[model samples]
Target: MPRFPRLTAAATAALALGLLAAAPATSDEPLVTEARVSAHFDLAAGQTPENIALDGDGSADLTFALARQVAHVTADGATSIRATLPAVAHPATPIVTSAAVTGIARAHDGTLYVNYATGTSATGVWRLPPDGGAPEQIAALPADGLPNGLALDEARGMLYVADSVRGTVWRVPRAGGTAAVWATGAALAPLPAPPAYGFGANGIKLRRDAVWVSNTDRGTLLRIPVLQDGSAGPAETRANGLDGVDDFAFPGHGRSVLAALNSGSRVVLVRADGTVTTVLTEADGLSHPTAVAVRGRTVYVPSAALSTQRDPNLVLARLRHFISRG
Candidate 1:
């Protein structure tokens, strides 16, 4: 059976206060009306959609976290296979028991980079050309690490990854160089569980000189500054005690983020001041929603469905009065 650890005491408190540490930007009115959005796409049974990347034309390419395939999703929810990851190349490690593609990001030139954990020791970041050519292995991560969320800092020529197992963030050069550990903190470690899920920092986003990351097990959103020397500064919590926080997107530019609650089967809008509003829930038709992507006012989510014992699928929701700063 699929397992989702219950929220710890800290997380429970945050949820009670609507997942905010400061007053909201405006009135207590909900950010987006619940009924204004609808499903934008669906996936095949057993297709575990994990992360999504928006293309130049507004289409989204999705990566299956527990599968070896990538899918191209159109604006209307149409999907097609884009690539199939090859089998594990290196010897296996006990750290990463599952071999799957966990995260994906697209470059401005239309190229795609994907992180594959064939095993802990066999994990690597592969790059695919815009023309769908053979994938090129760019950088191999540590044998004890598990790479998950991905974000690109084009100006810095760096691609950042969240190592869920190691509880650290790594910086990989876009032009192919050795990957280096960029930042880490206590907040990135998973909390105690009867059966551990091996999840910590799950989602990462870059805005200006700061990078934001979400801890799945700890239910916290943290921000780390990128210094003048391109090194990471101390990590600070922006919000805590979130519920089932998995992957998130900055829909209101840097003003707010839309997060997917994998275990709760809901999506929430979190403001700059830490105000949170439930944008969609299971009652709104989501089922174990794992990740989210934003393009303009539209938010896309992939429901893994394992928690709800249903087939995995993709759903879309639109905001009524939301404005994106991106």
Candidate 2:
């Protein structure tokens, strides 16, 4: 079966321009434009923070669970050794030893919650107190056989886990007990895997009344309107054509959803109206960033050292507020 090209007449005419124009048309949608990606913020040496966790203590903590260890440092400092996820992969690792903090959530009351969607079985979800010391297991929710992404509903105290393997979105209480099947739609379906996310869900986030799921396998973003009881509303494609969207950041008081775009050395910003723009070029030396979070105006992104990872590359970039085009 071949894809019936959805090319427009303008695109068809552009194809007449030569093979170069048609070259880009083959991909259907181009998420980034040359204008949006105008700057690059190189990675900081020591305080290279991955996975930004905004704490109520007015301090920002970064999680690095790579090479079988999950540790935390400050996004505001030049690298400070604090604590590590004690589950230990081979030695003292993040949770399941090699699995890192894919997604993290914090309550208004200042409770810290973390998710372990990869690595070994001992890995799951954990919680930290307001002051931050040791993280304890909540209960053992039923995550997709191989979980990876997560989101938190602070007001209602619900945690949503994106089980890419099972194609299911699971929910559990803040205290942690039994994982309940919250919503099962495209996420829980028998989608293909790897290279193309038939069901490869990664990053998840909650805004006002909805939850956003990132389909890295297919370069699409799903926004499922959620209710107070965890029931889902209409699910729609918020943004697409991303180059492996590992994580996203909503630079507050603005209209930008800055994302950690893998496969490329930049952070892309997608507006609410579905128009995409590139905000940074060669963002913090990002290497397929896997996790991201935002606080007020600042943005934090964590890159995965896939190949030659020397030292640890954790990046914290301040997302400049976008000026309205109108």
Q: Which candidate is the best by TM-score?
A: 1
Q: Which candidate should be chosen as best, given lDDT against the real structure?
A: 1
Instruction: Compute the lDDT for candidate 2.
Output: 0.54
- Which lDDT tens digits does candidate 1 get at residues 155-239? 9899999887778899999987799989987888765553666678878889779988889878888889999999999998887
TM-scores of the candidates are 0.85, 0.72
**Model 1 regions more than 4 Å off:** 1-30, 33-45, 89-96, 193-196, 323-326
Error of 2 at 267 (Å): 1.1
Which tens-of-lDDT digit does each residue in 1-326 have in candidate 2? 00011246643222111101111222334333322211122222222233556665435555543421234444344444445555443422211223444456667776767765444554567777767678777746443254556677767877887765566677888778777877666633434533243435666778668877776655667788886566887668877787666667565533347776665645776777777766555433555455656554455555544321322355555533332331
**Model 2: how large is the Cα RMSD against the reference?**
12.0
lDDT of 1: 0.72
Error of 1 at 215 (Å): 0.5
